[model samples]
Target: MNRFNWTYIDHKNERHHVGLMHGAQSGNLLVYCNTDILIIDFQVLHSHTYSFFIEEEFCELSIEKTADEQYLYSFDLNTEADTPLNRYRKKLSKKHLWQSLAFLAGFLILVFSLTISFTYWNKYNNQHQFAYGNGIQGRETIAQISIDPESEGKLVSYYFVANGKSYRANTKFKENATPFFKHGMPLIAGDEFVVKYAIDDPTINEIDYNRPSRKQISTYRNRAIERHLAFHPELDLDYCSCVADIAFKMKGINGLADLYFQRVSEEENPKHNINSYKRLVRSPKFTQRVEEKCWAQ
Candidate 1:
């Protein structure tokens, strides 16, 4: 059983005491005005409103569900019956509702603004750290490249392994950017490149095109070719080696590195079922080179 009480004053300056007794499980309710019992019900299974008169003045008692799914009891007293106290109560209720909505809107705006500010701040902080912090040399594998729909700039996505974990990131280059867009030089997916990343946070990194020398490119190309031939034991080593050398000559170090990294990525994810070597063999340049260098007498 739960008990609730309230006090009210009427138009004639008369004092009144309003009290209620509720039996939650039994659905029994008792309402009292001063010492007089005004209403009684034994079947109050849900929230309800009760209206009664005291000294010719109107009064209302309501039970309703609150925000936390709990029941609340409210009492109101009116000086005249013609005043329609419920209408006034409804107006006050609407005022509170609007106030609550305004408060919520302001809170959401503040949170959104803070989120945007923090994101920019974090990016700026990371750039600063990468620029001045002690960074270690790391190898990055170019995963994909596409033109940004909004900026129409070339976006290069890449990944690197650090501390035995892989981290992925992307950079954007305008169409006129040097080296990347130099005549006869085309950046493609699966290219391996040099990168330096903050030792403490691998996410802060950038590509360094001048980092790889010709010798390093040869080493990468040879290692990749060796792995590919091992994986496909039936492939002719002379033909494969000729094709790889032709590809390096055609695309330069970046091109050959791309082929090597693409093979590495494919090996790492066998389910992808991609054969970059076959694709290379099918290209006209490689086919022509294979005939001229490996088979032509």
Candidate 2:
């Protein structure tokens, strides 16, 4: 048996305070409203509201939206029966207890495994990070670019040689776009950028370009490009600059051995016309020219 103290106003605007009781034997809620008694089935519409039907109309009651009424009710439902259905329900609750405990044990084991894995990964990362510092300045001898076979569309890898040693790095694009260089510029093969190494051990290396050596390399490359433009007036300064930048970085070259240019124009459609070629020629004799005229033995 459950009882609630409630107050409601009638049609005469008189407040009537009464005790609303649930009869467990009858399985009906007892509501006494102004000299009349109404029996309604107890139902919960949601967490905040309780509902019951009276005279073919739905009635809603909630603590937050109470117009001029209040009620105190118990959440626990009390029932009594010696039926087989009641006995079966009690048996089912006891059976579910072991299943609940097993689920909890599995959840705890998964959490423990993840914790151990994360700890091991953190330890490995910290040890490797400490070994590699800003790398030493090393001249790039060769630069190789290749499309990644494992991925589709604009997945690439850049492999380069510095001081007779090889290194690899990867890049991907959202669209078909040129690979970016340091500072988000277009990256070309044979471009000279600073390489980083560990201070204690030089073998641990990386190509992150925020190094002090880049400024000195850029200055040297610019001087070589100026020398190339002096000898060839027909070549665009911008085109010669790109070639010289790659050449000087690759082999400390003062000028390119071969210079070539091309232009494509369509008379029918101006929009389809390519004004000039973007690629710079890399000559086989370029290294020989650098060895003869630039660096002395």
Candidate 3:
């Protein structure tokens, strides 16, 4: 017999006493109370131990082991088995927790890969529209610059003419050229710029800023003045003549004048990317920009 305090309540009555229990050979329990004998069959009964205390009114009466190492029970005659919500919390050991984390990480990676693929496809579609569209050949011209309505002032698109028809298209500026990579060429209203375009599809075009006008060249010279002075303060070279020649001759290859002055400053410091003079001699554009724009001075 397992001994523990037992409480029972009937309508308008309460009783408290010891409970005695005995198991029979047939796997049934005989519980003896003050005035009643209750028989429970092991085959038909489900039991659980309460690791936490539960209120008598809400408790699921299951045969339980108390902290004192005694077997006891609360009898709920209405229910035979535990409901899902009342069942014990399934233990999640560290190994299982790690497995769950790994699954979540893999799911996030899949989502990120899909997002990137979609974004790349979207950009490619835009690029294809501009690259393969048809346009009439026209003399080099300066495109009128306007704020892109779709992107606000954050970006600008160019409007040009081909075959006497006006067309609009956005040009792809190099990354980090300004705030947004799509900011287009930073050309002014009257700045000399040109593009190849399809007559039927003006949005499909290629812009060329290689041949700037005299005003544009002057602007470039002014902008580069501070930089040139910072690098070669004592030098007496004219900024416009130095940079415009290199820009038109080299099609705006970067670091030309800087590298030239760098060599002049320290001849022993080996030449930069432009190591071969023969390469420049072979370029007709180089001779043309120099003869027409630079050495004419």
Model number with the top lDDT: 1
**TM per prediction:** 0.40, 0.28, 0.30
The list of candidate 3 runs beyond 4 A from truth reads: 1-140, 144-153, 162-166, 172-191, 209-222, 230-297
Cα-based RMSD of the predictions, in order?
Answer: 16.3, 17.3, 15.3
Residue 33 displacement in candidate 1 (angstroms): 19
Candidate 2, clashing residue pairs?
135-196, 135-197
Model 2 weakest lDDT span, ten residues long: 253-262
Preferred candidate (lDDT higher): 2 or 3: 3
TM-score of 3: 0.30
Best by TM-score: 1
Model 1 C-alpha lDDT per residue in residues 1-297, reported as the tens digit of each score: 779988787646888889999877787899998889999999676889999887766888898856664678899865435655656666788999999999999999999999999988986677665666534433343322333446556565666677787777766654435233211224444545566666666777776555453444666577657755766678777765765677778666544544454544454533211365456657897778778886852
lDDT of 2 by residue, 95-154 (tens): 788788888898899899889888867644543674342223333233344556567764
**Model 3: worst 10 consecutive residues (lDDT sum):** 175-184
- 1-297, model 3: which lDDT tens digit per residue? 333346655323655332535342233454444655433435323345322212222222357545764445675423223533233222335567888899999999999999999987855665466566423332445565555546644365668776687777664432224321111123444444556654444454577566555665555455445444566577446644464347534633233333333323234323322343335534686667656655656
Question: CA lDDT of each candidate?
Answer: 0.65, 0.46, 0.48
Clashing pairs in 3: 134-198, 135-197, 135-198, 135-199, 142-193
Better of 2 and 3 by TM-score: 3
- Per-structure clash totals for the candidates: 1, 2, 5
